[model samples]
Target chain A: MFAGLSAFPLTPLRNDEVDEVAYAGLIERLVAAGVDSITALGSTGAYPYLTTDERRRVARVALEHAGSVPVVVGVGALRTSQVIGLARDAADAGASGVLLAPMSYQPLTDDDVFGLYEDVAAAVPLPVIVYDNPGTTHFEFSDALYARIAQLPNIASIKIPGVPAEPDAARARVEQIRSAVSDRVTIGISGDASAARGLNAGCDTWYSVIGGTLPEAALAICRAARSGDAAAAMAESDRLQPLWDLFAEHGGSFRVIAAIAELGGLVTPNSLPLPVRGLDRTARDRVARVVRELGLIPPA
Target chain B: MFAGLSAFPLTPLRNDEVDEVAYAGLIERLVAAGVDSITALGSTGAYPYLTTDERRRVARVALEHAGSVPVVVGVGALRTSQVIGLARDAADAGASGVLLAPMSYQPLTDDDVFGLYEDVAAAVPLPVIVYDNPGTTHFEFSDALYARIAQLPNIASIKIPGVPAEPDAARARVEQIRSAVSDRVTIGISGDASAARGLNAGCDTWYSVIGGTLPEAALAICRAARSGDAAAAMAESDRLQPLWDLFAEHGGSFRVIAAIAELGGLVTPNSLPLPVRGLDRTARDRVARVVRELGLIPPA
Candidate 1:
């Protein structure tokens, strides 16, 4: 289920609406790069921003462009019913699975958290990947809680965001859960900065932000890591280190998708939802410089 | 703007759907208790968990029950577009204003944060109240950025969650912003525990989760505070101290909502979103005891 690199592409927007044509082009590029799966309507895709119809349109365009590639759609929402509806829409749009984040609102009890997943899992027929990004949810999944969720029939994987400060602690937590759940649940590592470490810790999948913009390089790294070619994987990772550094330098995960979109020429002066300021000239130039160094853009 | 107590009533659910009848009843209680305003679809109302239709229905029901009392609707969403849609719906539903939380993503840049508020402020015709609950969003609004956002037309107020580790720092920042922006943006403090502290910090409004269930007592506390009856406010606050303690004992915001719902007879056997472990019997009993102490339930 997790052999090749999967890309979560950013959803392009125009006039405060989904830009389907641009989104199709981005999806085609990733599929052409031999990506194993493509995720749409993810945080990268600004899933929450899109209208229900707009989200469906994006999903339709993405699935169409992806052709035979597995399309995983993000189905996170504040309400369980909305999530269920999104899950249905994703499945109808021909998605292979859905990734779910914890319901937002601080300090959700373990029961409420579990109930949300159960409601979504039961509502959608597709396999569901539980996304545990405590950074966004402000509530981390305890190992004991994750283990209980892993036992659910339709839950296929867990997406854990990599922690730069204590990579080992995160890795150990993932490994512990993986062992507890055994083959029933696969672990997917988010945060390309710690992909190598996560993979070494038995993460079955790696969802790369950089990969969405540069699938070839991301895939190569994944292939190397999978084949136990540590040197090759590290080298590829190092080559892309500048881009990762750019993501870190420009406010980490928050701006990474927009930065990638700017580099890929998918959108002009990429924007985020209100209250998110745009990157300055200096920040944009830094990204451009790294993109050129990585041969992401032709040297000029 | 910041002179009175505002209550966010629980949006009751029945069999996995919005229970509009119960919702109206809840709002009626709050209105009867002399609450200055009612906030619908706020985090306590489980705004994120309800479907759009459910949210609309609840808002309509609440507005109807609230009569001419100003109704502020929470329109926070991960996407700017969605927030705009919600703002439109809230306006149509007769809400007097909108309460918006920042986007739910990790490591949001200052630009993203600013963009979120700006977009929402621009989208809704009604005045917008920025909800700055970093405890849930994991993205705090910096003083510099909040100052800029406060300057946006239609940006009327800010709802600062009471649980920040450094409430004084937030207060200082708000004061600084207010000095720069004039009274264009009023400040509202969330969390019943810190309502008095927020008032002392020069906040314009006090919002209460406990008020969802204990409207009479909550409004009494607010009236006392607003009338400069510090002694009475403190006495009323002390009487409701058990309610605040339930929040402390249950360990988070959502739990407090669930506990209060049970005490109010608005819901039976309270539940929360999944992955969150349910409150244990001991915890539930603790909550029940507090409810009894508050005279929220008839003496056995």
Candidate 2:
């Protein structure tokens, strides 16, 4: 179920509202490029900013566009009840699975952590994928906790943040996790810039944020990686690295999504929530130059 | 509106439900102890874990118990709609003001940051205090951004996290922000342990997490400080340093909250979220010893 590329699409907002037409176009482009599965309302999708109604609308639009492709909905909320409610909504909306993060408020104890997963898993009939993005949630699931959570039948996979620049250390940690949960769950590496090392670490699924912005390029890399073509995967990663770096240089995940949305001409007057600054003229020029060099789009 | 010790009381949970009885008792204690104000549903109160109904119930309880004491309710949410709705609820529930953190999702742009305050301020008639707890949000509102947001009429105060020991640079940053917005906004320092330094640096309010667990001791220290009794304030702080150290020694804010909650006998089986391991026995013993030494609680 988790063998190929999963594109976590960025939600398109136009003038403070969800632009369904642009969202459908983004989804259609990803599906055409051979994305195996799609995730909506993830970090890139600005899931937190979305109201319950907006989340349902986006999920429905994504599902309509996916048609046959499996669509996983991001269902993280600070409260377990809200998350469970969203999970039910996602399932009702015809989602194949839900990407759940631990409760983001209080730091959860191991028991609390496991309980959170159990609550969500029990609340929905669809399979669940644990998303460990400490960068946003400020909580990282340890290997032991993951191992324990993996024993739950409903948890189908995990999306681990891609390893840092140190490939070997990242590979080792992934290997340890793989060894512990190999029988129970699939492992997907996020942070597309380091997807190559993740594959080397034995991860089979690649969750791509870039895929949301550049579906063809993202799919090509995933396809190359799946076929055991390390060189091509690395080449694709190298080409995409500039965009990733641009996101990092600006700030982190949200800025990157906003930048991508601006680039796609899908959202205008794009903005992030408080505390995150937007791309400046310098950052915009850098992204434009990279896009031009990569032949992804015409120069701005 | 901005002076003395402010207590961010814990939201009591009984049988996995909101314990309004216990919460009201806690608020009564803070108010009786001469706490300048009480903040309901802050991070210390586990606001993020509470359902909207639970949050409203707790806010109601705090307001009822507060009587004439000003109760500032925390109203930050990942979604703008949720925040607006919560702010309205808080105002309707009779909270004196709303303490808001920038939306916690991806980092926010200056426009997004200002927009959040402007929208929240406009949505509720009550005064608003801009909360800047970067430790949890992983995003810092720049002095420039804070300056702009502070210009809004309802934006009455700023809660900056206390200076970390390292990056001695934060002291200067705090001063710079104070310089820009001090006239328009009163600055509140978050960490009780850092209150002495923060006060010296021009912070007018000491918003206390530790105060929730040790109301009398915290108030004594605040009163001492307000009256220019630095020696007494330092002495009380010295007594509390080990507990603060326990928080710093482990996971910053998460560990501190969990430790204090355990000590106060508020929540049994207290635990933090993932990535943050709970205090080990050794750390727990140290905290216990400090609590005892400071006469923070009676001997068992």
Interface RMSD of 2: 4.8
Off by over 4 Å in 1: A163-177, A200-202, A271-278, A298-300, B163-181, B200-202, B267-281, B298-300
First chain TM-score, candidate 2: 0.93
What TM-score against the true fold does each predicted structure earn?
A: 0.89, 0.85
TM-score of 1: 0.89
**Judged by lDDT against the true structure, how good is candidate 2?**
0.76
Top candidate, metric TM-score:
1
Candidate 2: segments with Cα more than 4 A from true spot: A108-112, A164-176, A262-289, A298-300, B109-115, B122-125, B141-149, B163-178, B196-202, B249-300
